[model samples]
Target: MNIVDFSKEEFQNQQIEASHLEEILKDFRRDGYVIFKDIFSKDYINELNADFIDKYGHLFSEEYKKNVFRVGHRRIQVSVELKKSFNTPYLYANPFILPVLEGIFNTEFIISDLTCVTSLPGAKYMPLHRDGAIFKGVALAPLLPAYAVGLLIPLIPFTKLNGPTRYWPGSHRSPLHSGAFEGNPNFIEPEIETGSCILMDYRIVHCGNPNQSDEKRPLLYCNYSLPWYFDSSNFRFDPHLIVDDNNYSDIPEEYKSLFQRRNMKLQ
Candidate 1:
């Protein structure tokens, strides 16, 4: 159940697969962000989408969709099945993803939670904020590491027309300021192709852009973390338990650690 128990050879192989692992670590350490292109395949995305619809249909209901809003206009936030889907091997056990995470976090990690974000047409903009801020009120901050990374996997190509995520690179080192976005010119848009993944530092100042296109911008966001951190999702409702146990072992050891830690903490 503990991540620290993973074999050394397995961990080393993960590093080898993530050949650019050092570069990503450098980016995160210095700029607080990095991107990995085409981490998932089209077939993988399709499978996840089908699984989501089958297991959590209520999340796409009218009521849930109605409550999601953006700062400037109406917005839609799709249902996230963090715990329920965590046990899926395709998600947590991907060879490419686990190694990349290993390079970035450089520690025993776990799959904390995931969110399926579907930005409907006309969705409003999200305010600039850091993901770590979500844990500010919780007493678990000291027990956990300061960094929590979000792996943003776009199910559809994230282009300027679709309101892709934007961030001020290296801004994570600064304190959050109310006027940070006031005429500031450092922000840059990250254009991600379908199947590409972006690894972002939780402290980086970022926001979801509004989708101008007629089509919805769907994305899968998976969060990985060290064992002691707190999860924003209610782990008790996670759908991972419904999956067969054989599927669990197929996932990479790194992800297995993440899944185990979250389950242990919630239990």
Candidate 2:
């Protein structure tokens, strides 16, 4: 199955049951992506949405226009401030997410990016692209193991009329580039609930579907990578992420290393 329904699974200390780990990994490794349903509660998602609205609800407002990056025709990616509700561990170091990531890397991983990509009404489909290249100019780039992955949490439910993401299954292992997926019949755009989160390899070919509905669709995008890796693409206008000194200090000791790039002077 493309989506793993974790809502019915048993949980020990808020982590998925051990029995489901194999299936989750299998789907991820084979398809280069997987979706976990019911990763968070609706109340939690509502709170996150509220927090995001407080800061960036008005997309064209004078205060936040400077913080917005025009990613597509009507789609904008805004860097989230790592303070208050945005910096909470429940959102970043989620229990249901970290274990699956650990299995994929089999080593320590660090969070490299945190931003929200909002698709406004009339937002068009994006050019199929990978968030980060594994090893540019290398012949064996596609064959290499995943060096980075993206964790997407939607603040609102992703609907068919809204801008749900479309993915080409198992594309991460192929030598295909962004242009390879056009006219490809094999694609899936799973309608995800607010609490569910999608995990995808960095090399996968995917794009956002147009938002035919009137409501805006905002997705919290988080990238995690091997400690040695850094993303050199997709942030030409903005920095990789934002985390102030106070927020960095608020992170749990175990996850502090994930924000190693944060410096005291950063605003």
Candidate 3:
């Protein structure tokens, strides 16, 4: 299968027509993923990178005390104190994705998880896997609608050396196939730039490749799904809190609605 690409302009009309929506949905259903190129500005990406480095780079430094959280030794998940000031939700909430999400989950969906993954040099290969498994068996596994999707924004220019994500085409509809994690014969590694973003069907079989380069590979991740599913990777807040809790009141009002899907609109 060929890697499909779209532009931000094509989806800039505020309202996406049904025909356009069908075209995108068809490609996603067939290929398991889509790339929107040059959707973000370089300056914006640079700012995000700088901010990430400022916040997480230190944790990786000599002063490392306890802030760094690692999925692996090299895949650092930087937990920002102020989650709201992070990247804007507009990119993830773009017209191209919102329409398809609405079609899958109908009228409502929410962002269950949000975090950034920076794979440093020498990051090992990740075992291919699904983000969530609602159905493990049965004939319906391949035909059931998608319950979750992920939006990946590259914070730096991606190259094979820095380890771009490796994805299997059309695997979103199937059960976990054996030997896929060890390096499947059918996989595509699309080379996208910093301004681009990948919309991935959460059920799709994918894995992170080893970083051959010396630079850090940073990518912001956000997962959206039907309200019923609680993402295992999600950071659930504590209900019992003291007055000295993390100060998040300073975050933008729009950022908070993501937790409840209260502020999202399909149209």
Candidate 3 collision pairs: none
TM-score of 3: 0.80
What number of clashing residue pairs does each candidate have, in the order they appear? 9, 0, 0
Per-candidate TM-score against the hidden true structure = 0.72, 0.91, 0.80
lDDT of 2 by residue, 82-127 (tens): 8777787787788888888988999888887788898888888998
- Give a tens-digit lDDT track for model 1, residues 33-94: 77765555667676666666676545445677555432234444343544443455556556
Each prediction's whole-model lDDT (CA): 0.61, 0.82, 0.68
Please identify model 1 stretches exceeding 4 Å from their true place: 1-19, 53-90, 134-146, 232-255, 261-267
Say which candidate scores most in TM-score.
Answer: 2
Candidate 2 local distance difference test against the native: 0.82
Each prediction's Cα RMSD? Answer: 7.1, 2.6, 5.4
Supply candidate 1's per-residue lDDT for 104: 63
Rank ordering of all candidates by TM-score, starting from the highest: 2, 3, 1
lDDT for 81 (candidate 3): 33
Off by over 4 Å in 2: 7-9, 61-67, 136-139, 263-267
Query: For model 3, what is the error of residue 93's alpha carbon versus the real structure, in angstroms, after optimal superposition?
Result: 2.2
Over the full model, what C-alpha lDDT does candidate 1 score relative to the true structure?
A: 0.61
Q: Cα deviation of 261 in candidate 1 (Å)?
A: 5.0
